[model samples]
Target: MIGSTSWVIPGTYYENALLLEGLVDFVELLVYTWDEDTKTLLFNEMDKLLQLDLSYTVHLPMDRLDNVIRAYNFFEEARFPVINYVLHPIKGWRRTLGEKVALENLKELIEPHNRMVFDVGHHFLGKKFPAHLKEAIVEIHAMGVIDGRDHLPLDRETAAFIKGFMGDLITENVLINFEVFDLEDLKNSLKVWSDTFVE
Candidate 1:
């Protein structure tokens, strides 16, 4: 399904979620920061969040396992039904929440159960997802890479690529997350995607 990152605008997750309720099929919750205020904001808004007509996938914190555990605990405690948990390869990382984790690129893991979340921009840096790993991709982080930068707003060419060679993941059912952080980026990406990336 088509989707956008949770922080499409500069706002709290709940605020962004509310803003994006009907705009996207799902919100890739950018659950990166771990702190009391962030916890309080999300916790207080959890009940209201359930009321929104939106689905959720979670991008767990990439750096710290403690934060990952906290994120998992938060979602589990909230009884959040996430589509998948996108994970970046981390040192000393192990399965924290069963097989729910969709291991992100930048590393190769050979375990049969190891699912994947492919980032198009990251692929620009190197290491395109191998054909053997096709079955493992559960999500696509769709965005652009200008110069040496990645995850910028998707231009028409990039959007076209998203549904073509640059994206064109084997799994047709996998989620296509805009993965952009700005509102204008999301708007442009969506329009360009719908216009050029015909299903």
Candidate 2:
């Protein structure tokens, strides 16, 4: 079951995601805002999302590290059946929250009901984690940044590297979000992925 994000599907038709229910496996809902006041404003949208029959894996806000716990608490209180809680290995506070400390925090914070979203793009950005951390991963935000720009689809060499790195997880059916923001790039990347992995 392949999936894509809500932002790329063309139009302000987020709720119309149900239309693609047959065509796609799931819709990744991006929750980029996690402030308490903003969450109050977003309550209706959250309610609407919770009601959807579609599966979801939320992209937690990465603007600041402070919002991390709040975002997790919000989902916990809402009781949404989120497939995984996606977060970047944020390097912003690496002086204080180095990879080891950060991963330990995540291990302690996340409840058993939810798994983690591994962002290999951030890993490329110097936010490295131990290979053992793969145990907590259920979804992968799979893209590699070559230059400064991100969300770029993986080239053949990079894709091959990722396939070898991921190894058993792919065979285990762990969800992979291509992380391409544009529709055309997403389609092209899907074709590349199918050729390499699916086909």
Candidate 3:
């Protein structure tokens, strides 16, 4: 399934979700923080969001595990159509979170069989893309690391690599999120993906 980061236009999570409705298969909510205000908004907009097309996947907080637990609980209780939560591998939470979360690669390549949200930009920055991790991949954060920065649009330098790698990486079960923030980058990446991979 094709996905994009919720930061695409920067109005509100629900606003973006509504805007992205039908544009992609899912929208990965960039939940870097879990607060009462966020909770209230989600609660109020839950019904409206549920009525929209497409599913959801959340990018949980990269730091604290408590926030992760809190965020997941809300979505869980709502029975939201969240594909899976993408998290930077935290310590020992796997036992608790179980299959609900996909550990993303960062400083280390996590052990396989625990589902993963493979970030192409992360590996590109480090210049390592191991085939072994593919076995664990359930979702992909597809963006390019350009000029020492990650999450840039898929430019020519990275398009060839993305096409080459994704050709083998994509599958019926895997979700590919463009993961770009700017509208222009998202448009470009979507086009590049279609041009290079889809047709």
Flag regions of model 1 displaced more than 4 Å: 107-113, 166-172
Colliding residue pairs in candidate 1: none
lDDT of 1 by residue, 8-76 (tens): 778888889888877788888887867788788878877777789988898888778888888887887
State in Å the error of residue 188, model 3.
Answer: 1.1
lDDT at 13, model 2: 27
**Ranked candidates, highest lDDT first:** 3, 1, 2
Provide backbone clash counts, one per model.
0, 0, 0
Could you tell me which 10 consecutive residues in candidate 2 have the lowest summed lDDT? 96-105
Stretches of candidate 2 above 4 Å error?
Answer: 9-23, 35-42, 45-53, 64-66, 88-116, 127-129
lDDT for model 3, please.
Answer: 0.79
For candidate 2, list the clashing residue pairs, or say none: none
Model 3, 1-199: lDDT tens digits are: 8998888886888888887887788888888878998788878877887788878888887668788788888888888878888887676567536567887877455545558777887887763656766777888888867788988887766777766766666787998888789878888887887777765
Q: Over the full model, what C-alpha lDDT does candidate 2 score relative to the true structure?
A: 0.60
Q: Output the better candidate (1/3) by TM-score.
A: 3
TM-score of each: 0.87, 0.67, 0.90
Evaluated at residue 136, the lDDT of candidate 3 is: 77
